[model samples]
Target: NLRALFGYMWAHPGKKLLFMGGEFGQRREWAHESSLEWHALGMDQRHEGVSRWVADLNRVLREQPALHQKDFVNDGFRWVQRGDWEQSVVSFLRLGNEAAPPILVICNFTPVPRLNYRIGVPRGGYWRELLNSDAPMYGGSGLGNYGGCEATPMPYEDFSHSLSITVPPLAALFFKPE
Candidate 1:
C-alpha cells in the first residue's frame, strides 16, 4: 500500500514525505521519547527488504529528472488514467524539462493483478521498469514487467504511444524511457 501511495505521489507536484522508520515498515507507532527499533531489520528479512526498496526509491527520486525537475510546476505532471477508481487503479506521468522525456507511473491499489494493462505514453521507445514494488526482494509476489516493454504507436489514454504492462496486485510500477 505504501508503494502504491508513493507511486501516486510521485506523479504529482510538490514534496513527497515519509516519516522516520516508515520507509522500512516500522510496525509500531513512533514515539518522540525513544529511538527507533533498529533491531527489527536484523530480526526480519521483510524489514531489510523494505529498507532496500526505500533506498532505491530515494536514489531514483534524486537521479531521475522527471521526478524532481519542475516538481513545483503544474506542467510537470499529467494524468494518463484517472477514471478507474472502481478498479483502484491510477496512472500518470512525471515530466521533467522539455529537453527530457517523461516517466510513467502506474499504481494498482487493489489486490487483483491486472495483465495487459495498456497506458499512454508521451513517446515511443523502451519503457524500462525503474521500480517494481512487487519484486521478490520487496517481499512481494515477484510479479513484474520483466525489466521493460516496447511502446507501440497505438494511441491510448489520449496519447499517441502506449505500452502494455503487467500491474501486480497491490503494487506500483514506475517506468522510464530508455
Candidate 2:
C-alpha cells in the first residue's frame, strides 16, 4: 500500500515531498530526538523494497520530463479512466512538452487482482512497463504485464488506442511508449 501511495504521488501533478521516515517504511512514530530507523532496511526485505521503490520513483521523476515538467499546468495531466468505482481502479496520463513521451499510470485500490483490464491511450504502439509495484523485488506477488503491453486499435474508452493489461492487486503500474 505504501508503494501504491508513493507511485500515485509521483505520477500526480505538482511538487513532491517525503516525510523523514517514509522512505524505508518506518513502523514507529516519527521522533525528532531519535534518528531514522536505518536498521530496518537490513532487518526486513519489505522495508528494503520500499526504500528501493522510493529510489526508483525519484530516479524516474528526474529522468522523465512528463512527470515534473508542466506539473503546475492543467494540460500536463489527462484522465484515461476515472469512473471505475466498482473495480476501484483509476488510470491517467502525464504529459510533458511536445518532445517528451506521455506516461500512463494505473492504480488498483482493490486487493483482488484485475486481469485483462483495458486502458485507453493516445497512441497505438508498444507501451513498456517502466515500473510495477507488484514485482517480487517490491515484496509483491510478482503479478504484472510481463514488462509491457501492446496497445491495439480497438477503442474502449475515449481514445482510439487501448492496451489490455493485468493490474496487480493493491498495486500501481507505470508505462510509457517505446
Candidate 3:
C-alpha cells in the first residue's frame, strides 16, 4: 500500500516531498532528536524493498519527461479510468511536450488482484511497463505483465487502442509507449 501511495504521488503532477524516514516505511513517528530506524532495513526485506522502490521511483521521475515536464499544467494529465468506487481502480495518462511519450499510470486500491484489466490508450504499439509496485523486488506478490503489454486495435473506453494488463492487488503501474 505504501508503494501504491508513493507511486500515485510520483505520477501525479506536483512537487514531491519525502521526510527522512519515509523512504523505508518507518513505522514510528518522527522525533527531532532521534535518528531514523536504519536498522529496520537490515531486519526486514520489506524495508529494503520500499527503499529500493523509492529509489526506482526517483529514477523514473528523473528519466521520464512526461512525469515532470508539465507538473503544473492542465494539459499534462488525462484520466482514462476514474469514478470506479466499487472496484477502487484509477488510471490516467501523464503527458509532456509533443516529443515526450505519454505515460499510463494505473492504481488498484483493492486487495484483490484484477486480471486482464483493459485500459484505453491514445496510441497503439508496445507499451513498456516501466514500474510495477507489485514486483517481487518491492516485497509484493510478483504479479505483473512480464515487462509490458502491447496495445491492440480493439477500442476501449475513450481510446482507439487498448492494452489488457494485470493489475496486482494494492499496486500501481506505470507504462510508456515505445
Q: Considering every candidate listed, which one attains the maximal lDDT?
A: 3
Candidate 3 residue 114 C-alpha distance from true site, Å = 0.3
lDDT of each residue in 1-178, candidate 3, tens digit only = 8999999999999988999899999999999999999999999999999999999999999999999999999999999975667889999999999999999999999999999998899999999999999999999989999999899999888899999999999999999999
- The TM-scores, one per candidate, come to 0.93, 0.98, 0.98
What's the candidate order when arranged by decreasing lDDT?
3, 2, 1
RMSD in Å for model 2: 0.8
**Which of candidates 1 and 3 reaches a greater lDDT?**
3
lDDT of each: 0.84, 0.92, 0.94
Q: What residue runs in model 2 are displaced by over 4 Å at the alpha carbon?
A: none
Model 3 is weakest, by summed lDDT over 10 consecutive residues, at 81-90
Please give, for residues 1-178, the per-residue lDDT of candidate 2 as tens digits: 9999999998999888988889989999899999999999999999999999999989998999999998899999999975799999989999999999999999998899999998899999999999999899888999999889899999877999999999999898999999
What overall lDDT, based on C-alpha atoms, would model 1 receive against the true structure? 0.84
